[model samples]
Target: MPPIPTPLTLTQLLNPPSRDGLLTQIVSMLSGLGFSATDWETDSDGRIILQVEAQTLADLWQAVYKIAQGGYLDTATGDWLTLLAQSQYQLTRNPPTQTIGEFRLTAAGGVGPYTFNKGDLVVTYFDPTQNNKALIYRSTNAAPVVVNPGTTRSIQVTADSPGSAYNIAPGSVLVLNTPRPGLTVDNQGTLQPAVATGAILNGPFFTAGQTLIVTSALNGGAAVGPTTFTFTADYPDMTSVANALNVLIAASPQAGRITANVLNGALSLSTILITGATAVDQITIANTGTANISVGFDTGSATSVSGAYSWISEYGQDNESDTSLITRCINKWATIGTGTKAAFISWATSADPDVQKVAVYSNLFNGTPKAGAVTLYIAGIGAFDIVSGPVHANNVYAYIFPKLPIMTELFVAPAARNTKDVVFTAKIKTQYNNDTTKNAVFNAVQNLFFRLTIGETLYKDQVIAAIITIPGIVDATLSAPGIVSDIVPAINELITLGSVTPNWLVVV
Candidate 1:
């Protein structure tokens, strides 16, 4: 090409020579190559201080190299500049450390060791004390644990503890791989070791044949087995008495069977009827192939049954055995006319009456006759004179019996004497005529009524207030007053009966 460009000397590049003369020369050369210098600082002992910024690391490296060749290197006096120059050159040749985010060492039974590439920023923690105090070796150097990147090689390590940490290789992670197997419980409440090879058994001691109720946190169960020194003798009888009892307790009423006196020869079961309106008596038993039994009514055991029978008669009446009544009373009445006598009769009666005698009867009638002697004497001659006999006047009078008025008042008292100011609404019926010829008439019937009363007052108001409205009132004439006259008075009576004051009347 042409003659090579002459290299400028340090003295010539830094014309105004001083302690920081190389910094000026380096900055001038870098600026000429399109680099900017910033954040410049120098030590007390005068030395060139400079920092240059470029678009990229590559651009920065190129600018550095160019400045070094342009007589700036001759001006550099310290070892730091040399090191910095070497480091800069190495960075330009390799990819950035930030590009490699993380690295992991994967080791399996089949897969051996491998390594990550250079410039990797990896996260790893290792304790050499745990791994036989083995030092990490790379290439030819014995290295302490370092975070920087370099050449790749397999990492080797050994465990210090043979039992706890043995066979633990470097880069190996600990994982809880499997769960513990089920444990066997003995009658003595001792837990046997888990069957799984890698399982760990932790327990409290138990007694032999004393019934081991094993309750598992994972599966709900009471495991029962014999307490033996050997594992073979710890066979679990899942269907044993203790086990069955546990199962029965765990199972729901729908699924389980309950037996009383399981071991004893004698057993009795008392059951209440599950359905039907009438009371019934019955017993049920399940043999379970373990016991024989006899069941009968034991009169001697009546005392044991007494409490239950009394309970049945009281609150437990629904469970009682139905019995026949000794005697029943039937009231008798003459049934004289329209069977009204029966309503007036008391329940007690000595004898029954004949039905036909009082069935029906007609009203009697009579006629008057004239005297015969006077008629014979006046027949011929005295026809003129006999006509003067006394004249008789005929008249008929009808006597109507008026019905007496029957007045009835209902009274409601609170069950407790102290209860007061109870408010309630009620319905009442009235018998307008004492003849008892018609049904009681009522008015203004409503379903819901307010109450401020307590106990019996609460009940009485609710009952009497239930109005009965009949379609017809006995002997009710169109010209007479409406049926309300009777209803209003009855309601007033009921209100007084309920002892509900005006202030307490919440609403009707």
Candidate 2:
């Protein structure tokens, strides 16, 4: 039998040199240039790797790296040195994104014509001292707004901060204010339907000399004086009378910020910027009509007030980060080819910009199907886009589901390990702690098991080993059913942990 030939080191490669290939020659050249080289896992391409030593690692790596990069060595030879410096130079690229946040404004004063000037809104929160994070929004083209009176509008604003997008805590108060030159109000007056057919006062019969006084209050502005509109003719149709009153409000200088239209044979009034919470109060509708004229939707025959105003809070997110973008770029590169289930799963779980958790199964779990059918269950913040179209790039028999059923089961506490003693700090002594070590363990284990493609073993000892790292955890054990030595799942099934009780985190 022929004896195995010995491998050449950096020293041997440069000496009395026999024909030993380009790798040796490359190392010999690097040696002359005051750089050390070592053979680290040879490939079809002869790439000479630098040894991991303090002096040569930094100074020599830098000097020899310049030599390789001086265009002396081939491209393949430089790649090995490049890999060695991976820790120094990150390959991640920044992504182009805008930080998007929103404020939900709900208008009151029933069936309104709420006008929100695009540039009128100013929102401030999340460490107000850091004023750079404040978000301001307004109408783009016009001073007033185009909006449905009786609805909620979500105003999206682009915000910026020193670093990444600001993650505002949920339920944080979104203090909203406006400084536009207009009175904001929640004062509203709705028209009652017609009861009869007539040219004036059509809905209800109004005798001659009848009167309705319209009054409004402004937000941080002057009080709008009441305007009186009287019927000139006797027993006129509701339309003519309502029209006359609308004309009266529209023409009056005091009613400059108010408008009235005859809706369903009754007068419907809308105040400009006045809101209920700001000021806009004392909205009285007086009926000075003779012979008891009927007012529609008015609690009584004389006066009525507007409803109270309210608002809801919502959160916004900042733009993508450099790290997240690099992860996405790599994932996109990974999924560019034939869209196999594995490729799709990789994109969904790790690559797709939005997806965070995913599980892919070949066999049927939700419903029965052919042997080759594939199903994917995924979840994340706005991760529905991945499944909006096709599940796989090329496969036609794949189905995507929104949420997979969470498998819930209790695991008994591990048996007391009397042989060994473990010690942890007081923080992890509680069943559940703010430190989140337990949650981290649960998530890590879940990631290993709850995946699209299954056939992985869940070892009880592995979980126990993870939990033991928490502070104040003296000891831990794994009992049967909940967790044993190991449990192998079927190709179609995925395991999810529902909860872990305090009894399970035992100490001997």
Candidate 3:
């Protein structure tokens, strides 16, 4: 094998064999290029200084020389220095950066140009109930207030100030991600009011000696008494009896819990308005009476209230820090034209902070061409758009395709937001006897799944290891998939443990 090639760096080129000796080597490298290193020094700040002799006959030379005097290297020199700097930056840096993910935006019950201001927040998560606590970001652009109608352009922004670091992975759920500082124009927000149901009795009204039983158990509902209704005196018309029964049920102890009314000579029951934390479920009505009375939803039905908002369109990016840029520059140099499964995966995961998992399969699925086609399967945390604007399919192709040898074709697979289940069953023994202990164990199991990425492996041992780390879980065993093995999926498959089912008991 050929000897490993050492990088040509200023530090190495200026080796202290004597200042004259180093200057001679630099001059030799620049001799034919019309540039020469004349003098060098180390500043009090520890920055190395090098004075270069350049041919300044043209306007380009004049411009470059002036810029170089401002402490920045000339374009040619800067490019070379960047290449050298990247070689060493790998070991020191390489932290992930948040990507400018793309998403769609549409008006559900409103008009056009749903505008948002700078610092408008948006979020993605594995769970929806936890609000403003997921991967939160803000809009960087704030102009023309009335933006266009399409995908909302947004960048991953943090509330973090300088000197601190924050990171988020790609393939994070971008679709349906809640946009903060919601659209205030035209009263468009992220939430909508809940509606109640009103149903009519299609069958005949209550007859004499007939009884009706009502039970409420819908949407965290309470139990309504199975009240019996009977006619006091002989009645020619039963409509008044239905009205009387409606009044009776309406005035019952379950008034705020539920309500009943008579509409169009039919008994109408509706769920009363509850607080945001509470909701109403379907009520059960049984007829123990002799007459048959049919019941169903009325003309205007009550629906559980919900909120809707616009999708994200376009995309934006946060400003990359100097360290990140330098790391990227180095990666570009090291992996240029290097296309392989491993190389591509590394390149993609490093492409942006948001990209959590990646799978690349060559000639796996064929279409037009018989062979030489490679597809990259990428997934993020919550959601993200793969093809749009700068970070689209073509950009991905450039990163992987060029790296592959000639005659091999590369294609970026269509972005898939769906997640596959990585199920597991565990039995745990806890030391504590408190009610919260069991909950804590379950939470620990779920947390393991939440931390899993798209292409990450779900090892049985790792699961048990995680359980043992918890305070209450003294001993745990894998019960479901008894054999210990890794959940290794293909490159294109994005899998997640939706939930963990555990059979646990407290120990004395």
Candidate 4:
């Protein structure tokens, strides 16, 4: 090489340089110096205004070289100029270094006996991560003084006390010294007394129906009466008094009458009576006939005073009556008697004259009948059977009136027949009967018996849906509807089968 040309000084290269070209040339130089350039902005006259980083200066220089080789020397020169100016500006504007200090008080030294007044702030250096050094300083101190490094020292400084006095230095923290004694219940399972002077009771106690007495002494030296205080009973296990009472009511009756035992401070029942034919747990009765019979219940023996009593007059009579043909005829028509027998009798008498006999026989097929009769009447016609002795062992000796003619008069014709009407009516009647019978049976099984009606007319077409006689089973499914059917069958089945044992079955 003949001679090496000296590189231009930064100032010399840029002496009176064009502000427009300066940024570009500086950026190109920076790219060569290993700084990245991302973006560049220029003034309207092409002076570089801003430059950003996107790649390392070495990479940028390589890119610029490629561009220069591609005949983009102007772009390359502009980039170099921008980078040089930015580097020189940064060097001229370096930031000052920050100063910090660290100090610690001897462990023996704490917030002082020496007080600091208001408007005085003590300067302290502390590692935020470590405990602070306790320092004492005055508001009037002329200059900052370094505290003895390792020893505990009290530096006297005068300071005015602030209204809300607190001792805190610039880096010295404060810890609370106020007492924080926890409160707690002293007595549990009992009521707490009223808080009095100097009383320090705090609570978490179990108090149920506990009475507390509070007494106060008057300023005049007179003693006040003790004021009674009570804590409400909290029965988490049982809901309410009424609810508990209901539960008690629902529980099986204790073997005693419900008697208010004044002596025991409680309500209870008398001892169960265990004696006699009438020995019963309970009893119920319903009188359907015109005659009213008195029921004498001896709570002592749990027995009925009346022996062999009839629940329904018609049923009782029909049950005892002779089963003779003439007696049957009379029963089938005699005022439609009282219970189911009466019901059957009305049904038989209501049929057409030609159909009456057949209806009577059909009604009696599965029914109980009277014993006997000497004279039989058919459609108001009498037919006397001359018997030397009693016609039947349990025969009726007197006259047996025939059933009245079925609608001899037009005005007495039965209501118009509607299949729907019949079905609905029959269903309703049957349901009523069954319900009544069930109620009665339930009562009887519970040693409580009662009687209900089977209505004036029997639903001849109604079929028996079921006959449940399960022992100890109170609920029974009945084909019929209301009270009558329920009571009669349940009672009779219970009595006859001796299987069903429940004294009562409450229907829903």
By lDDT, the best candidate is 3
Q: Write the per-residue lDDT of candidate 3 for residues 323-416, one digit (tens) a residue.
A: 4445444445456446556567657656554454456666632112226755565544322332231243334555555567777755453232
Candidate 1 lDDT, tens digit per residue, 216-243?
1111122221111111122233123324
Q: Which candidate model has the greater TM-score, 3 or 4?
A: 3
Model 4 agreement with the true structure over 1-508: per-residue lDDT tens digits:
0111266343332233333344456666666778664343434222232222212333444554544433321222333433322342211111122111112223123322332232233432222212322222223334443333233322223222221011121112322121112211100011111110100112222334543332232211233323333434433321232233233333424212211111111111112233222211221111221101101111111111111111110110111111222233334444544334343343333332211221122111012121221111111101101110112101211111233333211001111001000011111223334333433233232121112111112222221222233222333432222222322221111111111222233333
TM-score quality measure for candidate 1: 0.10
Residue 156 displacement (Å), model 3: 13
Can you write out model 2's per-residue Cα lDDT over 1-508, one digit (the tens) per residue?
Answer: 1111267343332232222433355567666778544544554232422222223334544554454443321221233433322332322232333334444555544544556665556555433324324533332324454345456554544443322223332223344555322223210111111011111123434535655565665443555655665654543455555566556676675465555454334344445554333332334344433322332222123333321121111112234443443344344444445234455454454423333344554442212232443344443321121112122211211112222123311110000000111121222455544324443433333333323233245666666766565455556665432455565543222232322333433333
Q: Is candidate 1 or candidate 3 better by lDDT?
A: 3
Best by TM-score: 3
Using Cα atoms with residue i matched to residue i, what is each candidate's TM-score against the true structure? 0.10, 0.30, 0.34, 0.12
Off by over 4 Å in 1: 1-127, 130-162, 167-239, 242-246, 249-508
In model 4, the worst 10-residue window by lDDT is 413-422
Off by over 4 Å in 3: 1-337, 341-353, 363-370, 380-394, 398-406, 414-457, 477-488, 500-504
If ranked by lDDT, best first, what sequence of candidates would result? Answer: 3, 2, 4, 1
Count residue pairs with overlapping backbones in model 4.
73
Worst 10 residues of 2 by lDDT: 410-419
In TM-score terms, candidate 3 sits at: 0.34
For model 1, how many clashes?
9
